[model samples]
Each structure stands twice: as C-alpha cells, then as structure tokens.
Target: MSTEVKDGLRISVLSSGSTGNVTYIESPHERLLIDAGLSGKRIEKLMGDIDRSLTDVNALLVTHEHTDHRKAVGILARRYEQLDVYANQGTWDAMAPRIGKVDLAQKHLFAPDTVQTFGDIDVESFSVSHDAAEPQFYAIHYEGKTFVILTDTGYVSEHVEGVIKNADAYLLECNHDVEMLRMGDYSWPLKQRILGDKGHLSNEEGADVLMDVLGNRTKRIYLGHRSLHNNMQSLCHLTVASMMENQDFGVGHDFELLDTQPEQATPLVTL
Candidate 1:
C-alpha cells in the first residue's frame, strides 16, 4: 500500500447540536470547514480548542440551509474577506438571498453525484431527506479511503446507505433513543418529525445504519448530532457498542467509537 502522508485528511468537530455546530477539515493543500452553526464567539472558542483560528480556513462548505447549519455563515464570510463558500444551488439560493448581498467571490455550485476537490481532499455530495431545500450529505475522499458524513436527516435513506456503506469513517447521526424521544416532554409535532422517515435517526436506527456498513475497513465512527433534551451520550455509546458486539466481525478490534460533545470539540478524525 502506498503511504498517504503527502495528502492526509483531518476532521475536527467544534460543536454539533441544536445549540451550535461546526467542523474543521484539514488537508495538505486546503483548510476547510463543513458547517458554522455556532456564534462567532463560540466558533472562535472551538478554533482555539483545535489550536487553530478561523483565519486558517480557505473556504466554507455548507451541507444544507438550516440555521443550525448556517448559524454563522454570513458573519464568518464577511469577517474573512477572502474566504470562499461552496454549496449546491438550492442551498446557496436559500441562504444567499438573505443578506441581499454576497461577500465571498468564489461561490461555486455543488451538484449531486459530482466529484471534486478542495486542494488534495476529494469531495462528493449526495442528496439526503430533510425538510430544507435539497438537503445533502458529504463523502470526502483521500488516500484511497472515503469518509462519509450523514446527519440532520429523519432517517438513513436507501440512497444514503449506498454512499456510506463502504466508508472508512463516518460522522453519523445517533440522535435519540426511541423510548426517550417518544415519552419525553417535547411537543407532539416536534416528536413526530424526529421519528418520521425524514426526521432524525434514533439510536436503534443509527445502529441499523451502522450494521449495514460495518465492514472490516470501518476504522472510526463518531456518533454525532445527539439531542441533549432526550438523549444521553453513554446510552448512544453503549447501544452502538452492544449492537456492534452482536455482529460477526471483531468490531472493536480496529474500529473505535467517539461521541461528539454537544458543547465541545471532538478529537480530530485522522486518515
């Protein structure tokens, strides 16, 4: 096998929840960000946690048009005059019209099923089922391996299952436990969305998603986008761990599970 030292990929999560969300991706040729759902101050703190600054980013990549995904979009773009933004037409249309202006000069349109690059990091975008316009997930490629990120969706659709199945790493949604979500104190309508096919994936559902994809090459799994009101981190970790244990493969021997902190930065996923 060839070494990937010349073009390694690193993913760092700043925050990931209703409270906020952001992720930093570092490659040899580019420094990029996935989302900016946090306030400027919070994102700054997160950058500090990673021992980097917002200035390190060459551009920002948006997943969808939701606020939790766009919490600091315009602010950061404006703050850093040279920072470019990449998104699908729907997402850009949904967000770009808001400020009645554009700051970043390089706003590229992302089409589904397209393969492109941000420096040495290869990126692929695919459609996802969510309430927002043209919601999507990302699959990043580098060094003969792929890392797929699937979150903020009601469920893992068959389409997504295909894209994520053979990934070496995944930042997947393990939002809540079915029982806790149903019996907890959320409004009826809100609860329905969380459970719907277009809603977030519960711990059990997330496990099912993983089961379909748990091959030998799955090196890292970080269960993300957990709900603070209805879910506990330990439950998600334990539930996924137990389910993986039942599988035929020696799940824990090579694969490691990390939970994204709703209030803090997760350790970088390196490959």
Candidate 2:
C-alpha cells in the first residue's frame, strides 16, 4: 500500500476575510500561495503556525485585485524577492497600487484554462463570477492528487462548478446568511452589491454549492470568507452541517470551517 499523497502536498489557511486573506499550499517539490491579502508580518506569523516561512513560497496566485486579497501580495513578493505572481493582466493593472513597482520579469500572466507548474505542482486557473476585472479560482494537480480552492466571489458560475466537482479538498466561501445580511446594519448600496450577481456568496448559496459539488471523493471541507456582521459563526456552521447531513454527504467524515477572524490560528490540515 502507498500513501494517497507521497510528495508531501498540503494546504493551510493563512488568513481569510475582509481584513486580509492568504492561504498556503505546498508539496515536496512545489510551494505556492493562493492569495496574499494580509500584511507581511501577519502573513509570516500565519504561515509560522504551519511551520513555513515566506521564503518557502514559490509563487503567489491572485484571485482578484480587492484590497483584502492583494494588500500583502506585493510586499510578500518583494520581501522574498523570488515569488512569481500568477494572475490575468486586468487584475495586475488593478493591483498596481499595492504591488508597488515590481520588476516586469516577475509577473506571470495566464488566461483561463491555461496551466502552469511550480516545481511539480500543476496549477490551472478558471474564471469565476465577480465584479473585479477578472477573478479566478485554482485547481492544483500534485502528487497524483487534485485540490481546488474556491473563494472571494459574488457567485459560482459554470466554470467554477466544473473545477470544484472533481476536487479532493475544498476551501470555499460561506460568507453570510441571507436574513442576516438583509437585516444587518450594512448600508443599502453595500448590501445590494453583496447580494448582487457578482457579489459574495451567502450562506444558503454556499450550502447550495456544496449540495451540488460535494461527492464521494471529497476528503475534507473548510467553509471560509465569512463576514463578521453579516454572519454568525454558529449560523454558518449549522447551515453547512444541515446541508451536508440532509443530503447524506458522508456526514462528519468530511466537513469543517476555516475561521476568517484575525485572531484565530487553527491547526493546518494536510490532505
């Protein structure tokens, strides 16, 4: 018998939410990050929880140019002086303010369906629905296994659905419960955007996505990108639990939440 993963493939939620966002995925030969939204120091500490350092990241994959998702990307890249940023051109232009004056050679741009490698990990980006210039989620093939990360989007589209359907592990967005968002104190315009076709996913929508995507192959689940005012951790937890359990999606065997609060440091899961 052999381990499902032989080359040490793993992922850690570096940080997530409106404040900052970051997640690290690594393999014996491939080292990468999904987003770099936190400050340099904050991101370093988050990675330290999983015994990794900024220098260990081979590349940074940008989903969009939002402040919470790009704030630390340039700093992380510049400090390590080696991180290759992977994103579309529009997102790059939108991110110019944060990336500072990066060297031209360090930028790595790829269109949808294109795949690239970091050491041995094969990363493929697919378009996601959002208001940003062009946001994307990634599916990584490594050590003979596949994992997809879906986050920071207004809604899930056909392309995002296809990629996630076959994933082994998913770190997905479970932003807010509808009632909470509608009744919460957020301003009208902001609330409208949050509920728009290109806004973040609500708890019900997140659960619906799970109902459609979670299959026998999914090993673990991490609900993430929750809004503080628009969602309660308990509500988010119960909603997902009910959805999976009601659907009989291998209850308790593969379900969890990725905390988005600034103060949480949960144990890193290697799948």
Candidate 3:
C-alpha cells in the first residue's frame, strides 16, 4: 500500500547531547526515528509533545553503538512492532547485547554508503570520525530537498563534506568550545579524548564545517549535540552566528541558526 504524502519534509530533534540523542523525521508517507538514545518512554513523550506518536514510526536508524545514540533502539522497535531498525553490521554487533531481544525480522543492516528508500524519502549513510566501533551520519532526501544529519564526529572529512554540501537543511554538531572544555572539570584524558580526532566536534570546527557545506541552497541549520557541562546554548549559537557574520553571511538573512536543547524537543521544522 502507498503511504500518503504530507506537506513536505519535517524534522524534530527530540533530544540532543552527550546524555541522549534522538531525532524524528517525516516525509509525507513515512516517519522514522534517527538514533533512539533516549529511553522509549522519553521518546514517546517527546513525540507526543510535538503532536506525533510512536504509533506512526516505521523505522529506527542507529548511527552508532554509543549508549547516547542507541540506548532505546531495541525497546522502541519491540514496542512499535512494525518498526524496522537499521544500522551497519559493526554497529549492530556492538549494540545488540545492549538493545536485547530484537526480532531478526526487525534488523536491517546496511554497510556505509548504502542508500535505502522508505516511501518518498531516501536515506543514505556515510562514515564519520568517531570513537565508536563504527559511526556514521545520514542524509535524508525527499522531493528534491535534502536534510543532512551530522553529529558526534571529531572532525569532518572530505567524504562527509561531499555528502552534506549544499543541503536544504542541516542538523550539525557544535559539541563544545575548546577553551571551555579544556578548562572544565573533566579529567585530562577525558579532555584529550574529546579534543582528539575521534572525539566530538568543537564549536570552531562546527563553524568551519558549516562554511564548507552551506551555500545558496542551505535554508536552515540546527546546532546539535552540545556538551551540557562544557557548552552553553547561547555560546553555540553566537559562535556559529559570529563566524557567519564575519564571512558576510547574515544570520537571519542568509539562513536561520538554531540550537537544540538536550532536555526538550525542538519545534517541528518544515523544509
């Protein structure tokens, strides 16, 4: 049966941070969750806050095996019986024990660079530099519009740039401010790990990535996966905004810049 088409593409970040991460995306006919890091109950509540429900979710996409990214994958799939869970084989293997008791039929494994279609939306995965066994980001395409998902990467690579460039909307990471992170209470090793190439993106790096990928076609950018202890929402927004202004890109005129909160769901963004 054909799924009904809605207005266009809609995205809602249910939660974003080192604590837990989840995003909801819908393309008229299909609805899916990208990384159910939050518990199933939390995800449901967040969706309900946005006037959506778990009952409509057709699938779940796992970005990596990290608890903050895959914590509720299995529970959400099992609760919603019809939900299929997609992940790379490496991610699946690493996360399987944690997720627990997922039906074989619900598992949909794909290698990096694989493209899968669900109704009108086409989902593609690409590798990201992260500490996880295997971590990746996604690009969602629908009706000629592209919405890219990028977070938890220590740095953006050439391939990642290619995948995200000139997109209509971007959910990108601005995880922390280097100075804040360095001076914060985290241990030296923890600090180094976060500063490493396999760690999270710094605010500066996020700005650089935005500069690389954003173009005339870019409409909106959501700064996500911020570090609660080391980063402030205002800081992430202003840092990126300042960079854009310095480059002659008007914050409100060139594109919209917004930050996703770790504890609350962002309003539905239509693209």
List candidate 3 stretches off by more than 4 Å.
1-5
TM-score, candidate 2, is 0.92
Worst 10 residues of 2 by lDDT: 1-10
Q: How does each model score on lDDT?
A: 0.80, 0.77, 0.89
| Superposed Cα deviation of residue 183, candidate 2 (Å) | 1.0
Task: Give me the overall lDDT of model 1.
Answer: 0.80
Question: What stretches of model 2 exceed 4 Å from their correct place?
Answer: 1-6, 254-263
lDDT value for model 3: 0.89
Q: How big is the positional error of residue 5 in model 3, measured in Å on the Cα after superposition?
A: 6.4
- What is the TM-score of candidate 1? 0.92
Q: Give the per-residue lDDT digits (tens) of candidate 1, residues 1-271.
A: 1113235788887787656668787777778888888777888888877677777688888888888888788888878776888888889888876533555475778787687787788889988877888788788888788878888888776767887787888888898988998899999999998888778888878888988976777888888889898789999889888887877545567787888886699866576
Tens-place lDDT digits, model 3, residues 171-253: 99999998999889999999999999999998989999999889899989999999988899898898999987898886898
Identify the runs in model 1 with alpha carbons over 4 angstroms from their true place. Answer: 1-7, 97-100
| Highest lDDT scorer | 3
Give candidates' CA RMSD values in order. Answer: 3.6, 3.5, 1.9
Q: Give the TM-scores of the predictions, in the order they appear.
A: 0.92, 0.92, 0.97
Q: Model 3 has how many clashing residue pairs? A: 1
lDDT by residue (tens digit), candidate 2, 18-132: 6777878877766788887877788888777767777767788898899888887778777877788888888998888757977777788977667887788898888887889
